[model samples]
Structures are given as structure tokens and as C-alpha cells.
Target: MFKYVIQLILGFLTLLMSTAISWYEGSGIIDNPLEWKYSTPFSQIFNIEISSGQDISQLDYFVYAAKFQPFFPTIMTVSVLYICTVLIFFIFQLNRQLAIILSGIISCVFIVMSAIFFNSSTVGGNIFFWITAVGALIFISMGISLWYRKKYMFKFQPQ
Candidate 1:
């Protein structure tokens, strides 16, 4: 239980940190007034042109920003996966096998998502960095859970 709590806390911290980094970097969402220009393929395809002194903080901006790079999407996906895994562990009471299987699925998905950006011009290498870290964390947590399963079998107690 303590180990699971630590895993959850770590996941939450990573999610928060990644989100903060993305926001700080703007992921090309927030445009500067002095350097407002749109000459990329995304701009041409989406017909997006940011004018100087224009505030752009719409859902479209968020979506387009993600499309611009895999970093944001990868981090967000890992965050959601981490949350879901925690819920499955606590609420569903799934065994270690299921958790490990889910981790494998997540790894496959992460690989595909990261691969999609390999040929993209706008994709940042930071996505690869985060993906590696998230993958390691997921596997490590799963391994720890498996190792301690016999010692700490999680049971739902109605209180």
C-alpha cells in the first residue's frame, strides 16, 4: 500500500511537472506580437494565422498545439494512464498480471505515438525523453507491485 501510494505520488508529480513545462514553453501556442508569422505546413493546412496582439487560448489552440508536437500528447497520455492504473489497482483490485499487461499495452501505445513524430518537422525531441522516463516508471512500478503482491494483497474494506 505504501509503495502504491508512492507510485501514485510520483505519477502525479511527473504529470504536474510535464504540464508546467508545456505551459511554460507554450508548445507554440502563445505567439509573440513582434514575431507573428505562419509559414508552416500546419498553418497552411489549418489556415491558422495569428495576428499581432491577438489572444489565442481556445480549445483549438490546445489541440493544434498538441498536433505540433508529440511532447504534450505523450505527457498527457502518460498522466491519464497513470491515473487509470491507480484507479484499477485500488478500485478494481486487479492483480499484478493485469497491471503488467496494461503496462505492456501502454508501452505499445507510447511507441506508436512516439513513432508518429519521427517524420514530423515540428515534433520536439523532448517527447522521446519523456516517453523513455514514463516507460521506465511504469515498468518499475509494475515490477514493485508484483514483487510485493503476496506481502500486501490489496482488499477493499467498506468503512
Candidate 2:
């Protein structure tokens, strides 16, 4: 029971961390030793963009700035969330599974909302948003399925 609780907390944290994915757009790159930008000031100082083509397309530049930490935050958050999500599937209690499944639904809702704007947005924004949104949507769908199995598809008897 305690393990399940810990796993549930981790799962919730993962959901919260998922928002970090938004940070990738503004991920800054470096040109020369003196020339660089980053999602954060610290990233720029420690991370160097050595790519020959230092300039992103005008559209990509705008989108990247609009986002941030592409190389860091987004991946980190989603990764944490995914890890917790997997734990939730294998270990959480039925009631907690309900919350996790609901969270997945919420993620799906977020993606749908994003899709509405992505259609009218820039090419880069459109692509990134759609892919991430879809990923979130799929995760939620899978979670919901797992929850369904835990709830209605199985019967638990006391030992």
C-alpha cells in the first residue's frame, strides 16, 4: 500500500512535470564562443551550440523563443512523467488509478486545446505542438485503458 502511494505521488509529479515540454521551443544555440543563447542564462554559459548553421529559420526562431529549453526541460519533464506513468500502471491501487487515468484525460484535453491553436499557428509550432500533443493524447488513452481494466475488467478478492 505504501509503495503504491509513493508511486502515485511520483505519477502526479510526472504529470506536473510534463508542462516542461513547452520549454524546448526557446532552446538556444551557440555560434561562436561569444555568441550563444539558451533556454536559460545558465544553459547558455555551460552549453555551447556548435552547429555550423547557427541561425534557425525566422519562423523556427520565433517559435523556439516562444518555447524554451528544447534540449532540456521538455525532455526532462516528459521523461519523468513517463517514468511515473509506467509505475502507476504496474503498481498503483484501483482508486489511485482513477486519478492517474483522469490526469491522462486532462492531458488529452490539453492536447486537443493545443491542436486548435496549432492549426492556425506557424509551421514549426504546428509540427511540434501536434506531435507532442499526440504523444500526450496517446499516453492518456493508454492510461485510461489500464484504469478500465483495473476497475471494471478485474475483480479483487480479499486474501
Candidate 3:
């Protein structure tokens, strides 16, 4: 019971940090107008100057940039992944095999979602991006560690 509670608390903490960092990174792009050109959702939110004499309308820019932008999609996917992982942890508490499988699914989804940012030149260097990735990894590590202990490391006390 104690171990389960500890694991649950830690898992929640990891997810919370991941979600917070993802949002932080997403919001940081708006700090610079030029950076917003790479994010359609952000472009739609704010008008950005392209050059000394030229400016782009958010809608017009979004129409051109939407097909290539992954920033918003990654944030949404990670949020959903966080919710699903938390549910898996709570619902599969008694089934180690089920928990492990679900954790793998959750980890894979996060990996793919995170992969969306690899091609992004701006996102790769953001501190919040690294923090978010680390937080998600911690969540996966906690789940795997719990599953391993339950499957192979259980101890029996002498009577």
C-alpha cells in the first residue's frame, strides 16, 4: 500500500511538471514576433512584422503555415497523453502485466508526439522543451520501475 501510494504521487508529480513545461514552452514562442512565424496557432493569435515595410496578416499567414506547424498539435497530444497515463496508473493498479503494457503505450505515444519537435529549429534549444521531455521520461521510468518491482522483486518476510 505504501509503495503504491508513493508511486502514484510521484507519477502525478511527473505528469504535472510535463504539462506545465509543455505549456510554458508553447507560450514562450510568442515572446518574439519572428518566432511566431513558425507556429500557425500563434500566428493566428498575434500579428507579426515580417520586414521593415511588410507585415503579414495572421489569417493569411496561418493559411500558409498551418500545414507545416506542429507546435500546437504536440502540446495537445502531450496533454491527452498525460491524462491517459494517469488513468492507466489508477485503473491498472492490481494488474502488473496490464500496467506494463499500458505504460509502454503511453511512452510510445509521448515519444512520437515529442518527435514532432525534432525538425523544429527553434524548439530544440528551449530549456522548457528539455524540461518537459525529462518530466515525461520520469513518468515512464516510475511506471516501469513499479512494474518491475511487482513482477520480479517481491519479498517474503520470515514468519
Best candidate per TM-score, number?
A: 1
TM-scores, all candidates, are: 0.46, 0.42, 0.44
Once fitted onto the true fold, the runs of candidate 3 whose alpha carbons sit more than 4 angstroms away are 1-82, 123-132
lDDT of each: 0.57, 0.51, 0.53
What pairs collide in candidate 1?
A: none
lDDT digits (tens) for residues 90-134 of candidate 3? 656667677777776666655654565345455332423453465
lDDT for each residue of candidate 2 in 58-134, tens digit (9 for 90 to 100):
23333354343343334444555465555555544456666566567657765775665476444544545665676
Clashes of 3: 0
For candidate 2, the per-residue lDDT at 30 reads 29
Q: Sort the predicted structures by lDDT, highest score first.
A: 1, 3, 2
Model 1 misplaced stretches (Cα beyond 4 Å):
32-94, 122-159
Evaluate model 2: give its TM-score.
0.42
lDDT of 2 at 148: 71
Error of 2 at 79 (Å): 2.2
